[model samples]
Target: MTSIGIVGSQGRMGVALAAAAAEAGHGHCGVDKDGDVGALAKEANVLVDFSSPAALEQTLDACVAQGRPIVIGTTGLEERHHYLIDDAAADIAVLQTGNTSLGVTLLAHLVREAAARLDPAFDIEIVEMHHRMKVDAPSGTALLLGQAAAEGRGIDLGDCSERGRDGVTGARGHGKIGFASLRGGTVAGDHDVIFAGPEEILTLSHRAENRMIFARGAVRAALWLLHQKPGRYTMPQVLGLGEA
Candidate 1:
């Protein structure tokens, strides 16, 4: 059996991951915000982190020190965090994603394909809804979908995306990706990608019913990472959706 260590054990996602591990018949160790991840790392083959950005670096450091692989499901990570993951992957496997739903990962792939094939006249809009307790606007999943759309159109996201539009916003510009966010009671997650044209519109959407979707995906990713080489991987790779 694979021995797993969970960081941020007190959080919703972390607790869910712990329960999922138990349901999967895997060994698990949990560490809360003040817990020592380094000590826990020594007892497990892989670490799954669902903690905040502030705690993620320390968890990664602990995993690296123990020569253990990691699957990160945290959001709000900056570019520097990615650079650190890249550097660590040289020595141990690292899998990271904003969202861990298999369907969502597949949705991102389909969105990329659709964006690439559609005409420039198509205006792309990505909207996501999450629980009220979520602190981040434009949920990480929304950004992932937007990034996919940007990649499909062969443009940089930073150069062509508009987020959180306010009053008096004029007509949408060409080649610009738009994002909308919603927060409400107990919504696990919901994402929709709409491509609008002059006469017709096409949309793709995914709604998560439970947090188990994410927890299960993370566990599967951990299992998959055990067999892979020391390198960075994404949810698509873990689900065999495509090459990393």
Candidate 2:
């Protein structure tokens, strides 16, 4: 049985991960915010992190020091944090993503396929909603889906994407991907990718009913990462959805 250690043990995702681990018959070596992170890394077979961005660098350092694998589900990271994760992945396996739900992972894949098949005239737009407590806009998952769309259309998201438009904005530009975010209630997550054309519209969506799906997917990723060599990884690899 793999021994799992959790960071941010007191947070909502942390509690869910612990419960999911128990349900999967895995053992928890440590779960805490104040614990010796490096010690936990050394002792546990794998570490799952759903902590804050502030704790990211330190956690990556600890996992790297111990040559242990980690699955990261933290959101709202910046460029520096991504660079740090890339550096650490050279020493220890790391799987990082915005959302861990299997459905979302597959949804991203399908979005890519659809975007590739549709012409630029389809005008792709991504919309997402989360709980009011979430602070990020255009959520990490939305960006992930946008990236897939950009990849399919051979464009750069940073260069061709539009976000959070307000009044006085000009008409929608062709060949540009758009994003809209909504927050309220206790929504787990809801994402939709729409392809709008002159004649018709096609929308693809996924709604998460509970947070447990993410917890379960994170556990699955952690288990898969345990056997991988030192490198960066993604949920698509875990689910065998990589390009043929």
**At residue 235, what lDDT does model 1 achieve?**
90
lDDT of 2 at 174: 79
| RMSD in Å for model 2 | 1.3
Question: lDDT tens digits, residues 66-149, model 1?
Answer: 889999988888999988888889888999888888899999999999999999999999989999999987888999899899
TM-score for model 1? 0.97
**TM-scores for the candidates:** 0.97, 0.97
- Lowest lDDT block of 10, candidate 2: 27-36
- What do the candidate models score in CA lDDT, each in turn? 0.90, 0.91
lDDT of 2 at 225: 92
Tell me the deviation in Å of residue 69 in model 1: 0.7
Model 2: per-residue lDDT, tens digit, 1-244? Answer: 8889899877899889999999999987665677788988988899999888988899999999888899999989999999999999999999999888999999999999999998778999999999999998889899989988988998899999998799999999879999999999999999999999989999999999999999999999999999999999999999998741
Q: Identify the runs in model 2 with alpha carbons over 4 angstroms from their true place.
A: none
